[model samples]
Target: MTSSPSQRLAWPDVAKGISILGVVLLHITLTVPESKDTWLAAFNVWLDPLRLPLFFLVSGFFAQKVFRFSFAELFTRRLWYFLVPYVVWMLVEQQTKRVEYHWVFGDPVFDFSQMTASLLVGHSMAWFLHSLILFNLFLWCVRKLPGWAALALSFSPILFIAWQAQFTSIAKAIMFLPVFVAAACFRDAISAFASAIEAPFKGEWDYRSFWAYSGMVGAYAIGFFIRRTWDSYAGAVEVTWLLPGTEALVRDDVHILVRMVEQFFEVPVGIAVAVAVSYIPVLSTGLRFIGSHTLPIYLGHPIGLTVLYGYPMALNPREVSLAGQWPLENTWFWLSMCFVYCAIASLVLWALGKVPVVGWTLKPPPIGASRRTTEPPSAGLSLSQKLTETRNATTRK
Candidate 1:
């Protein structure tokens, strides 16, 4: 079926911006010294819960389209897109001690293998790249298949929870498939939801606005909650929750249901807030700016945040001790500043993409080469006659 630009879904960048911001918050939570304080600690705990899931969901939402490419084309294009940069950065990362290198065989090897694996299976922030690659592959295989088939394939997450207890690698791979599939299978519903909000509903209660706001708010609430809870529970809850066996699975299933319920309420709350903010001309315009640049923001934010978090303390001798200083000192201020900073960085990255060398990296490659055509001979002849004439002509030449 033909899809509109709206159906194409413009909010990926917005979601990407949110995802990158979540990554930043995760890093900040882990690294920030002041987090020892009660309130900040509590806040970070909450953020961790939804931070990574939010990123994975956004990825799943977009993976359906990637299912269209041929395997060779998809692998060659995407593999190199991330691989080239990832390798380059990991090498550079070694210079700064940002990466962990390992001994493989008798030689000390740069662990490009882990980096590569991260691009395929969800591996922390690295999983974003990994899940993306797999999701694209998985979606391509099932895109033309029936919706029910696709969803059945997507529901593999249940198995993932079971497997994660014994086989982390297998579990992660299986778990991610469902999320990626969910985005594709639910594409129609999500689009319908978006459209419903674009129009006005009776009274002030617009369904679209509600979802958008809910997703936004829920993103934050979940992010804050997970981080706080993990620390408090010593990260045991997540492990217990993912463990195998019927009893653990049943118990975790109940927790998952409860969390989903809370998320249902929280996401709408967040989305409602987003809707209200969107109605305000200034905030709306600002979100649009952030949303527009979100893709670049996603790719580039790692470098920028690395600078903000990694360098200041490393270079300045005393800054490491005072590194406890928060970027904006409060959620509102920090988030707003992060939004602006990422937006500007995205714009700059966008502009840089216009350059021949950089542009190639930012966009996906074309699917196929242009077909060439040659005109048939102006005059027609019988097969035997034509063969004889061609032979005679060749002899003469």
Candidate 2:
């Protein structure tokens, strides 16, 4: 079947696929029992740049497609699909040793009251989903304003900096929404840009291929930098002299400035890289598959981490560690195992989602939904019919 205009715009799918995989890597690197080791820390440090922002960018892009929905619809969609899963998973994590554990083993002491609090505040990996829900809500409320107004409101951190002389702490998580919205608003301009860049070169030197490769690497680099610097910034800020007395009162403003800079510069860079990767043929195919299966992968991997591998590893980390050590002298061995394990878990979940009765819950928009609305004229139609159609087309086209 011929692809529609929407199908041709498969770059987002590619980006999402690659994005989730990288996200998986981030999670694995963080959760690998020996993540505290210097080498692994360094690896995680480098992966910082694109992690959160990439997801935000994709969220903005997809959300834009449905921005016409009523407030209730938006909330329902996000609540049922994203928020519910987040809360459920948070509870699951609380009951298990996933977030808390024995002090000697890096586990925190567990209390039911504290665990309940953690649900509201979010804990461990759950925070990302919590933040995502908040970000979407904020955008949905402000989305009706003029583009510039919405953008300015969304970029309130920057404005807050000029107004209050300090950054806000919550600015970072939500700052990228504006960038995502901006990209969505200026999609035509951006596509023209990609086209222009592609026009000058031939073959591998062509604009599309080069930018795609460069963008992907650049996106990864941005993620790495964010991971590295944000961690350092956080650590430094936590104990900084800037937060005493009145400074404590003014801390939110200060954080706003920091987040504005981080998102304005870093988030767009990541989005650009993702967009570029989407255009590359092979990368696009792989990314689309991954992107298409994002929900399954996201929902299922935790089960693997929680039940299949996590407990087993916790019981005998040394043995699992040895199995994880097959690639001698390489730290990546641990990371690779985590990746493989998560993938397996995702695949299992994906399979379950395809069961005849239950498959309806998670399937994405069907491919048939992408078909064009206008139909071509029949070959057997009278010449007068064709002439009449041509006259109408001449008027409308």
Candidate 3:
């Protein structure tokens, strides 16, 4: 039996929500110097393998819809959707940082050259948006290739990035490209798998709980070990060494090898986690809501972090010391701070979206300038119906 579109989409939305929360926690832990060396830090490390990879996978899942578009349609859509926001936000982030720096140091600091370079390379979290545009463009170019060949071409940069580790922007885009492409290429397979497992849970409580809890436990256990193995190797390389050039090469090789190994497990683990979480009705609903608004939250969260934590620390360390104290030593506090930041950021972006032209910075145009005769499917429609509707809508354009 076919599941409703809401049911089919729930897992992906939950996965995205989980991933974005991970992103927020990571940023919080890293930004708050006091939060370092705590359990939250360790948790973030353990979660690293699952976070962005899962995100990229979901992005690719949706990109399948875009792939149906003609080149001109796809190009224009991506430009408006990804590139415009990226450029606008890059400028906003840069100016915000400059102002913060001037406030803290009592001297104006602005570097047009450095800003330009950073924009070209995607210097910060903004890199995700920039890289996403590139990924879509690259996928568009390779759409006509044979499946295996297309995947191979998309994933070719993983080795180079693993060895060099310096081509931050391009390397990251390439590293995650395979996941995205896999989603596009195997979209049917993924949906089938989700449907198969979710279908059995219709009324069977024992079966549903067993799979949900087991998958969650198994994925986390395997994911943790994979990350630990990578960490140990990374540590060994840092402490033990050969000749200078040889040592660097060895370290890079080990890092790349471990990363590849970790990713092998990470991808499945992430999917399992998403599936498991989706079984919890309450949590699933909350995550799906967050996932739906990911674009705004992703764009705006960093600003909230900067203004609330980063700027205060930079501008007046003493004044903010008390506020930052609790998060430093308490894991609960740290987690709370992360959630609080995410909430504020999401709310701020939501408010911005309510405004007229200002809202455009956080919202993208509709996927395609397509017309539809029938009303779009409600949340109750089946996945297959929704996909058919999407195709029909695009074809009409």
Candidate 4:
């Protein structure tokens, strides 16, 4: 069933909400000169190991039904939702990227072939939308495989990634597929696990109560170590061997494997944090709201960001630290700035969504909504209707 405002899963939405926010902060620190040297940037980068992996895991859980649909239904109902927004936004992103390229480099831009390649796989911010489509198709195609074999096979993409991290959106999609497929194939077990976690709160205490507390603590420790590892590796430090008694696989040239491994391990960490937050009433409410609106924010923020930061980056001016000597001072400042940037992007989307033709580009009529002419157009779909039209997606919220 598609989620409603009242019926939504708290942790997953909270996780998505947090992940998208991190994505925006990462964009902000990356582009805004003042934030370049701050702790916020470092934190976001450190989170690289888990953010997308956790996101894909949650998405896969919602997208489990993708395998049940016929091919035409998959394309029309499922893939179409993501592809439309991704392609539509890419036009906006590319035009901005091209202008910024010229400003910075004193040249037009990249080759047509390069642009086309990114178009196919995705580049820039809308890449996650590309993932929503590709992962659905991938799981559907491999639906016949035993769940264990399918998960094992999902790692096969790593063969290409080990030698060459893909230059486009494909890199992330490939890297995170294992987690996505696992979530999709093992939804029942995961749901049972979540139920177990929620058991303590529900007053049905047992072994699950022990697991809920201990597992979360374990996740935090593992998450910290993995984040530090990623930080080191991303900074050009060579990793110690992952495989015990074997140096055959670890190499400077193949650090992508380390990154991918860290990403996989980080999933539990993200889920644990998300669940922890779910218990906090205020934070969970806010995050779940943000999670419900993932599409517009995910697709919209980059356009404003492209315009805002594109030229500045193209100019390539020296950036200094906004880092404060006081504890968490830079963190607070960066957090505020990230909110402002997101607020502006959301404001722009809100304004544009009111415009006649342009608004539809931001939000297409949710599939099959137009068919019910008797009901007022703005009345919105019933949760059941939305589930049918948006099976590939979750709640339109």
Write the candidate numbers in order of decreasing lDDT. Answer: 3, 4, 2, 1
The candidate that achieves the highest lDDT relative to the unseen native structure: 3
What C-alpha lDDT values do all the predictions have? Answer: 0.50, 0.58, 0.71, 0.70
Clashing pairs in 4: 104-314, 292-397
- The regions of model 1 sitting more than 4 angstroms off are 1-13, 36-59, 62-124, 157-177, 197-277, 315-352, 364-397
Query: Please, what are the lDDT tens digits per residue for candidate 4 over residues 1-397?
Result: 1234446678899888888888777777776556656677778876776667777889998887677777876876677767776777776777677777777766566567766777786766777877778788889989989899989888776544433434544456557888899999998877666766667665677886677567756765775676566556544444444543333434533556556666776677677677768888999889888877777777767776666545544465433345653323344543465567676876777677788878777666545532334544224778887667666455555
lDDT of 1: 0.50
What clash count goes with each model?
31, 22, 0, 2
Please provide, for model 1 over 31-104, each residue's C-alpha lDDT reduced to its tens digit, 9 standing for 90 to 100: 54444453644665455334444455556665554555567656664454655444444333343334221211
Sort by TM-score, top down from the best: 3, 4, 2, 1
RMSD of each: 11.8, 7.9, 6.2, 7.5
Q: How does each model score on TM-score?
A: 0.59, 0.66, 0.78, 0.77
For model 3, which pairs clash?
none
Where does candidate 4 stray beyond 4 Å?
1-6, 34-36, 109-114, 212-253, 312-320, 323-338, 350-357, 365-397
